[model samples]
Target: MPLSLLLSLLAPPLCLACGAAAQVHQPLCGRCRGGLRWLPPEQAGAGVPLWAAVSYEGPARALVRALKFRGAVALADAMAAQMAANAPPGLLESRALVPVPMHPARRRRRGFNQAKEIAAALGRRCGLPLADCLERPAGAARGSQVGLGREERLSALTGSVRFRRGAAVPLRALLVDDVVTTGATFAACAVALAHAGVRDVGGIAYARTPGR
Candidate 1:
């Protein structure tokens, strides 16, 4: 049997949100899924049009935290499913998905980049290509963005993100992240891609902080 099937037989899958029994293919129970506060389509207002699957609250927030902090990498597929389903028409067409790059030190500590995992899953579901071309140069600030205001986050991120040297820059790219709170990260990445000759840039996040 497949490993996933064997694992399920050994241990039934549980909801990542509310700890209820869940379907093998989904990480959230029906109730938690229904409780998700979805957001309408909106631009990043940071020169990159962005779409988010849900609001960063309640079960949605729980799911993000589980994936980011608890290393529940399997949840990436479930999050990507929502993003693929709710994405605006033509958003994925001919566009490369570029995950927001985590600093090398932080990635080492976390063992993986949550945004890259989400982007990989999203790319599979959307049938799009991924452009893993962005990076945070050495000496860039690696402070957490949590609780930081928009200006503060932007200031810290300015000149911090850049496209990898000699990597093929895509004509149209969509930046992917687990969440969008202040939009500073997306804006900073857009600037980097633009500097690298990317003509069109956009963003997609699994969740958006309310009122952001």
Candidate 2:
């Protein structure tokens, strides 16, 4: 039997946005999915041109929270699907999807890196390569970026990012993240990639904090 059919027989699927009956692999019901506010291609900040799949609001927010904190691994593929659907033109044309790396200790405690999860899913769906180009030091400080000013966040992150040793950086790449706030983290990552010989840097996040 097909995997989707088998899974459906085991448990009826529910919408990721609202707990309503949903088809196999469909995380959001029509109403909730229609409510998502996809941003325009030009709506990017920081020094790099970025594209976010959805505003960090409503169903999108709930979806990201589920993936980031609640261990909803299946949602990674769903979110990637949304990203692929909403991606700007030429996004998939990049050499590979480079996920923002998590600190080793935090990733160990969490048992996974959400950004890598999302990037892997996106790569599988879009046929793009997955590049684990950047990494954070195990000793890097781990704390919330919330409530910090842009310069403060940048200062906290500076010199903490480094390109993976022995990995050849692409000339152009898309930095994948689950969320983008002040673009501080993205800027830091782009800087590291630039130092590693990556020229053109772009980004794709599942959601962006609105009104920032």
Candidate 3:
């Protein structure tokens, strides 16, 4: 049998949320996908205008957890579709799609930067150039930010990221991430991109947690 089929037969793919049989390379089944609540864009504080596809709840939250923690990388394609669907008008015209960078150590532990995967998928979907323009300091501290408030996240992430040297940064770029919580990471990325000479910065994420 083909490897994929063999694996599926041995360990049938199941939905991350409801344990239903999952489609090939997808974390959620059709019914679980239908449970992802769409969220409309609104003014999220300064720096860059942000757009998000779904609220960080229900099946959307489970999908993100699967991608982030369980190495269900294929879900990136699904998440990218949502990102593209919720993209702000004219954002598809951005010069490049830049993923929020993870510190090299953290990325090493995770074996992949989920944001980069999501950004690359989004770029393919939207036909925008993909760029790895930001680099988090290798020694930046690591911890769960789940309970931290907005200002706390900003304080923790302060001085944590900078533009990668010699990386091409376009005049207008869209920062991409799997989720947006406090917007601190996006704000920091905008500052880094601005320092590297990007004139305009906008952001897109698969999910957002309101009032975080």
The most accurate candidate by TM-score is 1
Candidate 1 vs candidate 2: the TM-score winner is 1
lDDT of 3 by residue, 42-65 (tens): 657445788888889989999899
TM-score of each: 0.94, 0.92, 0.89
By the lDDT metric, which is better: model 1 or model 3?
1
User: lDDT score of model 3?
Assistant: 0.84
Query: Model 1 scores what on Cα lDDT?
Result: 0.89
Query: For every model in order, what is the number of clashing pairs?
Result: 0, 1, 0
Error of 1 at 51 (Å): 0.9
lDDT of 1 by residue, 47-89 (tens): 6789888999999999999999988787899899998888888
Q: For model 1, name the residue pairs that clash.
A: none
Tell me the tens digit of each residue's lDDT in model 2 across 1-212: 96656867899987877889887777778888889998888865677788888899998988898887877777899999988987877787856889999999888888899999999999999888999989998778768887889899998898888899999778888899999888888899999999988988888899999997
Every candidate's lDDT: 0.89, 0.87, 0.84
lDDT value for model 2: 0.87
TM-score of model number 2? 0.92
